[model samples]
Target: MNKNNQKSKDGNWQISFSPIFRYVAVFCLLIFATIMLGGAVLSFSQMKSNAQVLLSNVHAQTSQRIDESITLLESLASLPEFYDPNVPPIEKVKKLDQMSPYFDYLMICYVDSNITVYSDGSEPASLASRDYMQRLFSTGQRQVTDSFAAGADGVTLNYTVAVPLLDAQNNITGCLFCAIYFDEVVDILKQSAATSGYEATLIGSQGQIMSSTAGLPYGEPLMKELQNARVIGTTPDKLQEQLLAAEPGDYWSLQNGSLVYTAYQRVEDTGWDLLCSVDFRTAFLGILPSLLLVAALAALLCLGLSFLLRRYIAGQMHSVDLLVESVEKLEKKLYQDERPENVDFNEIIRLTSDGLSDALTGLVTRSVFLNQAETQLQKINPEYTSALCFVDMDNLKSINDTYGHYGGDVALKNVGYIFREYEKKYDGLVSRYGGDEFVMLLINLDDEAELRSVLEELVLRLHSEIGSAGQQINVQCSVGVSLCQPGMKLEKMIADADEALYFVKQNGKGYYKIHQN
Candidate 1:
């Protein structure tokens, strides 16, 4: 061949390969960009999920603590002794003083029909001017107050729960109340904030801060804080509307020139909200390591694809198609929200209701049980006795090992059904306290003999068989009972019952024992 012709063919080959290299580089860049974008989205979504879980856990814990105060006051109201006119004021005061330690309140007090407050170690003082007092006496209903100056110190911020004392005819007689120090609640928020890297604030219905981990003043309006910080996703007014309506949501904002992400949820059965906030930059950095790892893998994959494209130019189109498909699958896998946003108040309410009951056993969860049981315990007639029963499924582990977890689950379902029936029959409170254990509050039993009879029925009923995997598994529970008095604390009763249960487990299983203490 001529030298010119040879040179021309070599140049043409070089030009052909150059465009292919450009296309390969462009494709690799596209792949890298797609992976990085997906990784970022996934990281942000994950951060939000973590924040939500933290917010939810803190909210539930705080709400439960507040609910106990209400339950304590309501329980005090049901003591017939408190309503008795003949019971001297000094005697009532002494009785309240004795029960003070058990109630975990700053003070347990009695307010008569005249709205005079008589507390342990304090002189009689009229609470007639308190709005909560006026409301309870006028409507004969329960009241949970916002933070205010209370207790003998009369300077420390406190919240109060008051219930009207009703006589035999259901006529309003007086009020039984308890005061919860505000700092105790703030401690709960502080602990959560310290561990979770999110500052938490408890807000009352009027938008005032009840407690805050961020060191916001106790009575400052939340809006005032917002006014100083710029909200990114929505206006302060809109956020206030959401708060006023007790809606659950998340938002972005800028505080002191730093990006912030916040989530808020309404505390159930109370006119309060829980707000959790975290520094956006700091939280984003948490997931940066994972993103970098993903990016490194993507870069290596891009290099491999480049080599394949250079060697197998004929099948480059097919390789690109496969790459696109993989990217789409990754987008689907990475970008999912753990909890869908609630579009309306009704949807939020529905979601809240879903968590109140246990999914597998169809019984109230431990927290729900605590709240309901305390309220019911207070309403029982003082003339009759009540009992707290701790029930442990004796053969759950054996059943799980023998017939698999399905068999153990079948046993629990049966037990739950039985306990639920008893709850309806006795008008009692029943809860699945933990794995393979349950708690029941049997109210208004006439005497120890009556309780024994009821327990016998429960034991015999629980001593049945359940079918699992084409075989029968015997399911039995050991019961420990603690008789309850008017002034007894729920935790003390639980502990006593648990001790008795320990005795039954150690001596023999599948039987019942009353607490000796």
Candidate 2:
């Protein structure tokens, strides 16, 4: 054919395919949009449900801790030594001090009607000015105080769990109180926040923030902080009223240009409220990969239809060059097209695959652990020493062999629990590296002596026997420790710790070793 004739024929084919391509593209786009919208809504609903469950779990745990304090104090109050007039305060304090070892409180003390606080190794101090003490004395009822400075230096924050002591005639004589360090509650909040990617705060009955994982100041009015954030669905005043009325509800707010969802629940038997908040964007992040995959598939379907149309049109024409040119143009367009802007595929990947947590251990996954460790190492203080640890479960295979995989799982769960306890206690990072292996990064240690003491306690705690199917299986672990040095990378520290762990396994299992050189 002549050049003009060929151009006319190619133009005709293009005109014929234009309408079909447009229709297919538009239909695919509509399908993609519908799928994305539905996916987003369902993702948000699932996120809300997850948030509610997390809040409920944290609330129950906080309530249980508070109730435990009250129950312990009440049990102690029933002791005759506390209410007996003949028993001297000094003797009572000695007896209380002996019992203190069994309880988790900082100290157990006896408070007289005059609000005189007496405990072992401390002079009697008058607590007359304390509001909770005054209320307890007046009402002859148990009282739980909010976080307050209680020590001689007036810098230590503590919660007072006090139960009124009654005499034989039912007259109030004195009170039995246990002073709990506020950091204990803070650890609970921190752990829940860390595992769930949320912030947790404990609010006093008077609307004061007793403890917050978000670093909200102690004794700050919860309403004041809410006022600073742009609350949605309700005014801050109404929210404060709901909190004061001990109502459980959820609220959304805009803080620092990010939307946050917060759920509040009242801790039973205490004038306290627990709030759990998370960034709203995270809810969508979990489902983004699926949405992206659906969109990609839709695009491919459209592309495939276009290819079929091109084939049919090419079949009608006798020229092979037109088909080659069309495909070349299509390939160029595919590569030259701009990618979607501002989409963080790395974050999307991280959010998926169990959402940055190990399903079995409830600890951060390896990627998260490495990121956190590197950040902390960069900011490490010279005055404090930090240590990295490699832990290997020694009896996992044996447990699985004898009692089945269920027993092995139980043993690993116990290890997770033990590691988490230490993580909270030491403010460390813990992660499950892979099968039967875990890593821990403990920062801000006072000295090697303190690290040694911690390792000793950890080893002792890990050497317990767990029961499986009416049979006792001994569960143990070997730990390898490496003290972090200046300018050391995470990989090197992990290698050192692994070497130490190898030494322990070679020498004797169920022990710990510090890396040498």
Candidate 3:
């Protein structure tokens, strides 16, 4: 209040406002510093939280896949080869061989030989020498193993899911086995990381990276092979200890000179850890410009700058507010992953049928069948075989003439309905090739007897009278069947099947015949 100064040249009273300006400037600088530093801390906190959630998601998904794999193997073990009393050994080999694209290496091991079955053909070998086969014989229940270098594609890490194929006397006749490459899993983890800005890795029991999108190179032991793993928290030995522990946790470490915050959870039922890391430097980079602006404002305050600096500082603070708001928006979007990574993996059925589903029949189209079946044939593993059936509806024109279009539609729909039922029952792919014509592709059929019986049953069902649009119409179909030979083109197989069906049509209207070639 004390105006102990003289008047300025104009008319205004001028006092030294330096001391008060310094105090007010310092206060403003403190507020600016708080905004900058506090936001960095908050950002890091959000990042760590997000990392934890993401890692948990990755772990849950992996565990679910493992469980699903085991359940599938268990169901497969109950099939004719494994459990049915009267199923002959050769027939068992046939049954086991028909597993589709899913069974990378399917086998039924007897005391004498190991029979490998695939969609292409079968191979008889001494499979008892294989480590996985031996392991399944010992474990008895469903088991999964990793990095087992027993695959044909040289030496790459793969996850093997297996179950003991047993006899009715509860004795192990052999084992049913399949392998999934770890790369498939890595792709899934990468999807999660891309959405949430996290790095993921799967560490084995001995601390080796079984699968990884971060940290030491995959296949190398994490503890011994860690390149430039600088310490961020505890000593190197303790860091190794904590990481190797099969528990859920969060920790800090430095990799390649950048400090990183890490969270990890163990994959249930395996010696694998699902780890996620958030880089401290990257996560907190948003605070740098604000801090620099605040430091400049503090310097201006020291110089006793007034109106210009005040206006500039206000604008900078507003920009900082906008930046903070943007980051918060980002954090929200990253955490909620729709179904939080409800991943429905696309598995195109390699059927010799069409791709697009017929709206009326709700089955695949003809073109889809051919393209996929070709792919399936190309990937044929020895001991695997496929069957192709060409079904020609008899007297469809007559049905159309008698009942008009609606009645004909009913007859066609009935054929599709029966085909779909068999498709689901035998795990085959069937399609509506055209009006009143249907194509059925049966992969991994070990026994022609079973396939014949199924076709015979389906024909009977097709012949059943359907009351539609106030009419009873019997659907008779001519069937042609062809078994795929090794190195056989799907186009050739389809032709043979069509020819066989032509024979059936020429001979009698409603009977099925196997191509005698």
Candidate 4:
């Protein structure tokens, strides 16, 4: 071939490959650009979604905690001795202290006729004869009052809840008052903030900061913003509305020049609002480098694809695969990890495994236990008889008050161990119902004699175990058993058992009673 023809042929080859090269180059650039953009979008969306989910979880957990705490308080309030009018103030204070660990703080103030503060600690001078307390009592409604109360050496914010305690005659007795000191509540807020990766604060119904995790000073700008912001009341519908109405996502700078991404939710039953926020730059800044690196790498890859198409595709596919695998593992860890045996249903299993389990004792929580019991009742075969026993630790609070909460915890754990031991023999499920209360579900307890024998043995074993513990504690429990029958409601069975338990308590301590047929 002539030299000119050879050159022309080579030129044609280059020209033909140019379009393909350009197309490949452009496509690679587009892919890289799309990935970088998509990642940024995904990361932002994930953060937002995660924040929402975390807020939802926080709302649920805190609400549950509050509910549990309140339930404990209500139970204490319902005790005949609490309103006996014969129990001395000092004894009542001691009883309140025994249950104090369940709450951040507690007070048993009287708001009728005069505001007398029967605080667990030193009385706050500013709170003495407070009008808010008077107004709340007269209104016959629960109130959460926020104010600055003078403490021992200084003043601190107070979040006070006033619940009307009713007597057996259905008349309101002195109010059952409880307050959480701002400092202690701040600790809770800080923990929530750390867990959710957000700054958090608890606001009162009037938009006052009852407690704040953020160390930033509360000033005019901050207060103004809080006041102007839409407030969410402690209700499910209101919380949902507040979350939905939140700016799809936005950044706002405080007067002090710190930017934040904030969201709010109302804690149900507590009348307290949870404010979740994170420093905007802190939350988003970490992603910038990866974003930039991806853009840079895309540019380089597009430029180099002219020489190495096969290698590029292989690398991209490998990277994508790894990403997919990582995500799958995360999902597995987050939602599908194996739970312990004996947890029959998925929800119960999840609740048991989750940190929602009580830290004091390795027993199923009240919520989980009740839910599991209900589930078992639903699935129970008519032929397989079961009994629900409600156990109450008599003088448990007295033991705790005398020996301290740590000692109380030890006693409760020992009791749990005894129940577990008894449970083994009877094929029963044992759970710490709450504080000093426990529940045992014994399967196949149809024979009356066998059921009575089990109860007697359980009581004997419990006493023996307590005697061996060598502590200066006198432990006793009251048990009420209700046999599960065909077409019986679980709630009614529990109620019957509870009634029998109360009867045992009234008749004599350290005794067991079965509900009359």
Best candidate according to lDDT: 2
- The digit string of per-residue lDDT tens for model 4 on 1-517 reads 0011212432221123567677876887787778766765656565565556656665666666566555655666677775777776556666676655555474434332234545545552334366656665577566555545744554655656566667777666656666656565566667666765666666665555556666545422335554444433333344434534432232333424544445667676555566666554545555668777877887777767655865665567667666656755654553355422222233423434765455555567778777777776775556555789999988888877977776676677667656755654455677878778898887655566777888898787556324223555567788998988888887888899999999999997788999987
Report the CA-based lDDT of candidate 3 relative to the real structure: 0.68
Off by over 4 Å in 2: 1-3, 6-35, 297-517
Compared with the true structure, what per-residue lDDT tens digits does model 1 show for residues 1-517?
0011212332321124677667767876787677667766665676577678779779878778767877776777777788777988778888887776786677777888899987655688888898888888888888877788865576888877777888889888888777777777878888877886678888987999888878898789999999999888689999999988888998988887767778899987668889888775556576668777777787677678767866786466456556656755643442343211211223322434777877766678899999988887777777787899999999899999998887777788778777866875677888889999999998877777888999999999999876655687898899999998779999999999999999999998899999986
Candidate 1: worst 10 consecutive residues by lDDT? 1-10
Kindly indicate the candidate among 1 and 3 with the higher lDDT.
1
Total clashing residue pairs per candidate?
1, 0, 22, 1
| Tens digit per residue, CA lDDT, model 2, 3-100 | 11224544533336777788888988898889888887776677667778778878877788878888888888888778777888989888888777
> How are the candidates ranked when ordered by lDDT, highest leading?
2, 1, 3, 4
Instruction: Kindly indicate the candidate among 3 and 4 with the higher TM-score.
Output: 3
State the lDDT of candidate 3 residue by residue for 306-415, as single tens digits: 66666676577667666656754643453343311111111212222344777666668787777777765665444545688888889889988988877777777667
- lDDT head-to-head 3 vs 4, winner: 3
Question: Judged by lDDT against the true structure, how good is candidate 2?
Answer: 0.81
Error of 1 at 79 (Å): 1.8
Query: Candidate 4 versus the native: TM-score?
Result: 0.44
Model 4: weakest 10-residue lDDT segment is: 1-10
Best by TM-score: 2
